[model samples]
Target: MPSLTLEQANQIIAGALARSKASGFKPMGVAVLDDAGHLKAFAREDGASMFRFEVAQGKAWGAVGMGASSRALMQRAKDNPNFFVSLAATSGGRFLPQTGAVLIKDAAGQVLGAVGASGGTGDEDEAICIAGVESAGLSAG
Candidate 1:
């Protein structure tokens, strides 16, 4: 299975930041994770809050772990709030059901990793994530 390279991760983060800046969003924090849900790269804009890092990481972690976009996870949580909340606790608060992240898929639709962002509305965050994935020439799902 092919994995996202460090160069690719860096590109994604750079693109995300650029998009966020262009949209006039508040300073953002972005995170990229490998297929195994391990951190590949992370960046917090100079003015981004400290909490952005963890929120960004959790969104990416949830995407990689569930093999779906964080949007999907959010819908699932709405249908099963108890289980979803418990899942967050079970993952020790490392899982978040929100729409600021997406699974990274290769051309063959293989899961490569995930990208996530914080410091904007969930929609804005998700938009940046999708932009990053596309900028990296990967699919976001």
Candidate 2:
């Protein structure tokens, strides 16, 4: 029953931003959410769009809610667009089935939270999330 700490959340964001910068990706926004789908931390780099945090949070929120990676949800949504649309409505527009977020898991495979990013391509965004999770000494799902 491990939970994400504020320090870990901040580390995740810092790692994500660092990765984005090292890769020469555009300015990025990152969000972290605990297992209960509550926002734990967030960051938007200078020059990033105002909407980045919302997009990143939406992606992570959906991951924490569904207990899966945003990439996985994106694939599922492709098979059932109607169902996903309904899900979005039920989440009050917070659920976003996109490829920019991943579940954060402990060594025992317990879900601790999720990390998500915006301002890059889907692959780029997902990569940064993974990097952040690993940097925090957690696994990414």
Candidate 3:
């Protein structure tokens, strides 16, 4: 089983920030988490709110815990609001069923970790996450 390395995590965050800047998005926060849902790397762009870090980490943590993209979790939340709400509590508010996060997978489709972004619109944030994963030579799921 391939695991996410600190180098890769750093690359992901760098790529995400670059993309966000090139796209003219607002100041952003990005987070990378290992498969165990541990923070591997994180960054918050200048001018971003202090809360952006928590929001980014929460999205990635939820993706890692659920073994799915945060976008998917958002859909699930729509279908089961109560359960999803409970899950947020169960995770001590570390879970966020929203867009802007994706599972990081190897070539063999093995999940290595997750990456998440905040401060932009959901679509913009998610796009940067996918871009970051690809920039790191990994797949986004």
Candidate 4:
């Protein structure tokens, strides 16, 4: 199975921060998780709210656990709100079905982990995640 190395994770976080800063979005927090849903790396921009870290982690956790982008999860939640809500409970509140997170996929399309961000609009968050994944030479699903 393919996996992201520590260097790749760090580069992704750095790229995400740079993109967020360039866009002048509010300070941001970024999180990267391993395929097992364990944290690989995290960063909170100097002025970002502290809660951004937890939100970012939850988004990435949901992506890795469900093997899908957070956007897809949002759609799934809309289709079955109760089920989705229950899933969040089941995951001990770590599963958040929101935009701003995506699965990290390898060349063969195998999930390696996930990246997520907060401290901007949902679209801005997602964009930074995509930029980060691309910077690491990985695909964002």
Question: Using Cα atoms with residue i matched to residue i, what is each candidate's TM-score against the true structure?
Answer: 0.98, 0.98, 0.98, 0.97
The residue-by-residue lDDT of candidate 1 on 43-76, one tens digit each, is 9999898799899999999999988889999999
Q: Which pairs clash inside model 3?
A: none
The count of backbone overlaps in candidate 3 is: 0
Name the lDDT of candidate 4.
0.92
lDDT per residue for candidate 2 within 1-141, as digits (tens), equals 578999999999988889999999999999999999899999999999888988999999999999999999999999999999999999899999999999999999999999989999989999999999999999999
lDDT for 96 (candidate 1): 92
Worst 10 residues of 1 by lDDT: 46-55
TM-score of 2: 0.98
Ranking by lDDT: 3, 2, 1, 4
On the 0 to 100 scale, the lDDT of residue 92 in model 1 is 98
lDDT tens readout by residue for model 3, 28-135: 999999999999999999999778989999999999999999999999999999999999999899999899999999999999999999999989999999999999
| Model 4 pairs in collision | none
Q: For model 1, give the RMSD to the true fold.
A: 0.7
Model 2: lDDT equals 0.95
Per residue, candidate 4 scores C-alpha lDDT tens digits across 7-42 of: 989988998988998898899999999999999999
lDDT per model vs. reference: 0.94, 0.95, 0.95, 0.92
lDDT of 1 at 51: 92
Q: Lowest summed lDDT over 10 consecutive residues: which window, candidate 4?
A: 1-10
**TM-score of candidate 1 against the unseen true structure:** 0.98
For TM-score, candidate 2 versus 4, the one ahead is: 2
